[model samples]
Target: MRLYTKDEIQHAVRLNTTVIDGIESAFTSLKTKKVAMPPIMRIDIPANNGEVDIKSAYIEGYDSFAVKLSSGFFNNPKLGLPSANGMMILISTTTGEPQAILADNGLLTDIRTAAAGAVATKHLSREDSRTVGIIGTGSQAKYQLEALTHVRPIDQVQVYGRSREKAEQYKSFIEKSLNMRVDIKNTPSEAVNNSDIIITTTPATEPVLKAEWLNEGQHITAMGSDAEHKQELDTNVLEKADLVVCDVKEQSLILGELRSCSNSKLINQVHELGEITSGLKPGRTGYNQITVCDLTGTGVQDTQIARYAYQQLNFKEDDYNE
Candidate 1:
């Protein structure tokens, strides 16, 4: 019966090793523990250029599970509002009753998504990777970069956005907050070229990155294609990658980059991130190999992050019981 606001949750959860490891552990549990995670339920509001996604998961041995509701209204920024917002509810397993309502206003989603990217990079990307290429200048663009610093020795950044003004703003934010050098690129190709780790965060319905732009020994994280119509990488990019991984195989086939790919053989070759994280399969077998991880977000991440945030707050149930 604990109700927490976004401000309270923000102070409790942050982008740190502890948070990153918690998310990584969720991935591990997905494979080893067989987490009961259902597919994401989405409702599209085409008239408003927005979509709402409902996700939830029940992990074994957990005292509580999380049900998260998050929305993305692409046109919100035009009205000076954020594009992402929502909340999560924690329900106890034993009692089958509500435990806590985490009204994080999508902050938990943002953090967990960014943490998932960091986990992908930590296990797949090269240890020596430093330079980063970011596509799309949004909240995620900044968050993705911030999360990368925790996993990689990132020092340089290149960014490409449709809006020059937003790109400039993002550059300033990164330079001031992370103290890293950032260069604005005229095209996605320009931004991706020569970068050790390339992250695509746009909500584009078309491919913003091409296969020809990719280089050997580089890692790419494609996280924007959480919908069936949204795609950031050319289908050829996935085909060309030496190793292609996904947050979930079935979900990726329906909602991620795999949904756009035509090659059935390539789709069959795709592996789940849990496989790599659980050590059942190898990650980055060669330093020169190209790796691509497609993340469409996952319910297990919500369950884990919500639980972690609740624990971090040091809540006492009796004090807030209704």
Candidate 2:
């Protein structure tokens, strides 16, 4: 089988609208019973401040599928290593043989996660949205804005971060790469106040966004709480949403923002992203609707992205030392 390094995968998988389109198709396949994706398997190692997640999915009628193992060691930065790293194993469904191994080190996850945001915003947000706000100043924060600009006509970016230096760094990066004016906000409320689309990308264990901060016609994509103990949006904010969507209903109800939103009486139904993508359910019914998409990440996204990268790269299966 071939092996693709992170650098090679990064070069092949350009973070652009094409990637977003592939992700959008994955979501549709998911809701239409064209995908078989299991619940995420997570192993938390509190002693090491780390967690490992295993995800896999098969698209019906496809010749291949992918299984990805990703880990996040929060303390790795002290050792001069990245906190997140992992690899993907692509397998041929027809013969049950390994096709390729992508040592993406979580780059695929980060890219697909952000592209998922753009897909959600494109279908759910008002067409006139030109401003974007994001919480956190990490790599996901940059990817989120980059994907947004590809799907929307974003002209301004407002960012919030705990560190002044990191916030400035994020601002400079956006201004240079996207050629858009980016404002560093002193508070999360300030960042969300005027933006048409707001994204919270932090791993905050408690609420960082409040219900009162959300305005009509605005869309919020909360992607922080991928574990049971993590959260980013207040429960009340989710309850008051005009429409609420989850990447996977089962995963979301168990560990995503939907866990806290389960008891809300205002929301009679919970929509899955795949369902919306497949046209089984409607998205963005009105210009004044308050839409929220809770993404916990899914295996179908991993498989789709893996397949895309494999198709773009030149295979080299010469690692056989036997």
List RMSD in Å for every model shown.
Answer: 2.5, 3.1
* Candidate 1 minimal-lDDT segment of 10 residues: 313-322
In terms of lDDT, the best-performing candidate is 1
lDDT of 2 by residue, 126-244 (tens): 99899998999999899998999888889999999999899999999988988999999999999999899999999899999998998999999998888888889999888778998
lDDT of 1 at 7: 86
lDDT of 1 by residue, 1-322 (tens): 8799988888777899998999999999999995889778889999999989999999999999999999989899999998888999999989989888999998998899999999999988999999999999988898899999999999999999999999999999999999999999999999999999999998889999899999999999999988877898899899889999999989888889999888988888888998999999998999899999999999999999999988876654334663
List candidate 2 stretches off by more than 4 Å: 264-268, 315-322
Measured on C-alpha atoms, candidate 2 has an lDDT of: 0.89
**How many residue pairs clash per model?**
0, 0
lDDT of 1 at 25: 91
Worst 10 residues of 2 by lDDT: 313-322
